[model samples]
Target: MSLGDEHDGASAGGGGTGQTRTRLPDSGAGDVYGVYGGARRPARNSRSLITVVGVVVLLIAAIAFANRSGDGDGDGSSSDAPAGRAAAPTAATGVKPVAGKNGTIPSGYAHDEQGAQSAAANYAVALGSDGMFRQDSRHAIVRAVHDPAVVDGLLGRLDTAYSGAFLKNVGLNEDGSAPDGLTFVSRTVPVGTKVTEQTGDAATVEVWCTGLVGLAGEGSTKPVTETWFTLTQKLKWTGNDWKIESSSQKEGPTPVNGDNRASTADEIAGAVAGYGGFTYAR
Candidate 1:
C-alpha cells in the first residue's frame, strides 16, 4: 500500500519527468469497427506503440503525447514515409540486447540511446523494491544506481526520511525487517519503457510498472495488493554507465482488474520466494 512517500524532486528542489495498460470494456458482440466506437477503437490507434512496448518491456504511452501518434491532429504524415500513413514516432523506437551487469542490478550500459533506456528500466525496479525499505540495502542501492554527483544529496535526504515512523507505518520493524511469520512484498514488474528524450550525454526515460506491495502471511492486516505506476528517471552517462540523476513517479493508466481469485497469504509468500524476478532492461 505505502511504498513510503514520493521522492519527486520538485519542492525538494527539480528534475523528474509509461508503458500503460489500457482497459476497454469487453464489447461482447456489439463491437463495431472504424466508427470511433467500441472496444476496438484504441486497438487501431495504439497497435504500433503497444506491440513494440510489450516486447521491449514497456507500455510507453507516457511519451505518445509528444509525438501525437494517435491524436487526430496530424496531417497524416510519418517521417521519411509517404503522406497519409503516420509513422511510428521516433521516441518509442528502442534498441535491444541490453548488455551490462552491476551486481544484483544491471550496469555497464553502453553510452547510447538503448543503454539509457535499459538503465532507466532497471533503476525503476530497484527503486520500487523491498531493498529500499532497509537502511543498509537502501544506502547501497542509492549509491549504486544514482549519479555520483547527486548520491550524497539523495542519501542525506532519503536516509533521514526512510527511518522510524515510515517503516513502522508499513508494518515493518524500525530496523526495516518484517515481523515473524510475515513477509513484506514490494516488487516492481516493468511492463514497458520509452525513451522520451535522448542526447549524447543525458536521457529522460519512463518505465511503466505494475507492483505488489503489502504484507503476506497469516493474520496480516496489510494484505498484498497490486498497483500500477510510471517512473520517470533522468539518467546521465557517467563512468561508462547510465546513472540516475533524479526520478519521480505517478499513478498509472491502469488496466481493468482481472477476474482471477486472490491467492492465500501463504500461497503468495511461497510463490514470491520460489519464483525469481526478471532482469527487465534486457
Candidate 2:
C-alpha cells in the first residue's frame, strides 16, 4: 500500500531543499501538482483520507528556488547586468525573492508566472505537513494560503474532514498530535513544478512531490514512510499575491525502490529535527 493510504493526514517541514516549479516531463522523471483561500474542490471521482490530506496539505505548505533569486526583480541578478536580461515590463515581477511569513507559512510572493510556480511548490509543503493534524495550526494555515472569498466555507469542510475520529484511525491522538513517545512525520517536498496554464489573473500549476508520513518510535504501528504524488493548484492573483482557488492530486511517476537501507525511527526523527526546510514557500 502507498505510504499515504493508511495515514490520511501526512507529516512536517525543516528537511533539506528549494524547488523550482515545472510539471513532470512525459519521461516519468516525476509526477505532478495549492494553498488556502482555496475554493472547495468539486467532488472527485475518488475520495479518501489521502486525497483529502493531499489536497489539504497543499492548502498550508511553503517554497525555495536554488538558482533563481527570490528576492530581486526576477532578473537573473540582484544588481549585476539586471541578471542577464531584464524581464519585459509586462512580465517583470519587480518583486522576487519572496519575503515575510503568514503565521509559520511563507507569504508575499511575486506577481508573475514564476511566482505562481513558487507559491504552489511551497504550498505543497504546508499542505502535506504535520500542521494539518492540529486544529489551531490548521486554521491559521487555511487563512494564510487560501483566498479570502472561499476561506469561510472551506474552513468548515476541512474541520469535518479532519475530525478526531479520522486522526485516531491514522494513529494520532484526537488532537492531531503524535503519541507521547512517537514522532509523527508528514512532510511533502516538491520535486519540481510546471505551469500548465496561465492568464493575466490566474494560473494552473502542477507540483510533483515526495512526501513522508506515519510515526516513529516503539509501539508505533504507523511507521514513517515515503509517498509520491502530483498536485494541481488553481491559483488566482488575490490580495497582491497568488492564493489557492482550487486543487486536485493523483498518484505517482514514483520511482522504483532504491537500494539504500531504511533508517531507524530514531534516525528518522533525528533527521527531521536536524535538517531545515527550504525558504521559497514564503
Candidate 3:
C-alpha cells in the first residue's frame, strides 16, 4: 500500500519563517474532519523568543523524565500517555512477526504486544488508504483487518463515509477513480505505535501517522495535502490472529512545522509512481 512521494525540505525544523499550506475541503463522513496544515510565521521579538525557548526546554525535560519513570513494571497500568507525551519506540523490538497476508493486508501476526502494535500500524495504513474508496478493495481490506462480526457494520458505515460527494470533494470520480490523466493520492505513513493495554486475547494500540490525501493532477483543485492523526484500535486475537475489534481516531500529536519546501504536484505524482510502499513489520 506504499505510494511514496518525494518531498523537498519537509522537516519538523526550527520555526520563525512564513509557511504556506493547502486547506482541503472535508471529504468524508464525520469521522474524517478537516484539518489545517502548519503555515510559516514571522520571527518573534527577543524577549518573546526567550520565553518560548524556556517553555520548550522545560517541556522537553518533563517528557524525558516521564519516559524514564514510566511504569515499566509490566503491570500494564498507566500505559496511555497524555497528548504530547506519547513517543515512538526508539528501537526495534527484534521480535519475529507475521509471515504473510490475508490478502493485500498483513495477517497472521504473533499473539503478543509487538504483534498487536504491528497489526494496529498496518491496519491504519489499510483503513486510511485510497483503496477504501472502492467497493471491492474496501471490502477485502475490512475483512482482512477487522473482526468478522463487525465487517458488515463497518462496510455500511464506510460506504456512507466515502460517499460520492466525498469523492468529488477529494477530486475523484463517483466510482472513486481519478479522472483520466490524473493520479489520485491517499496514503498513510505510520510514525510509530504504542500498546496502551494488552491481555492474552486483546490489546489496545495507538498509531501515530502522517498522511497525504487529494488528487495529483496539473489543474486539480484538491491538490494533495498532509494530515496528522493518531488511530486507536482495539484488537482481539481471533481466527488464530489479531483483528481489529473497534477503532477510532483523533487529530494529532502533531509536530511543529518543518522548514522543507513543498514538492510540486508533478513531483508528487512521479515519486508515488517511482516508489512503492512496504508491508510494514516491527
Best candidate according to lDDT: 3
- Per-residue lDDT over 1-282 for candidate 2, one digit per residue giving the tens place of the 0 to 100 score: 111211112221111011111121221322111111111122325457786787567655522232243444543212122223333322224555566788777777766666777788877777666776677877776678767886666555556655665566566789888889898776778887767777777887778777776678777766676767777778889998888766666666677564346788888888888887664642
Clashing pairs in 3: 2-277, 9-260, 10-260, 11-258, 18-40, 19-40
lDDT of 2 at 79: 17
Those runs of model 1 whose alpha carbons end farther than 4 Å from true positions after fitting are 1-100
What's the lDDT for candidate 3? Answer: 0.61
TM-score of 3: 0.71
Q: How many residue pairs clash in model 2?
A: 39
Rank order (by TM-score, best first): 3, 1, 2
Write the residue-wise lDDT of candidate 3 on 38-78 in tens digits.
22233433456677788889999987986786535342223
The weakest ten consecutive residues by lDDT in model 1 span 32-41
List the candidate 3 regions with Cα displacement exceeding 4 Å.
1-92
Clashes of each: 9, 39, 6
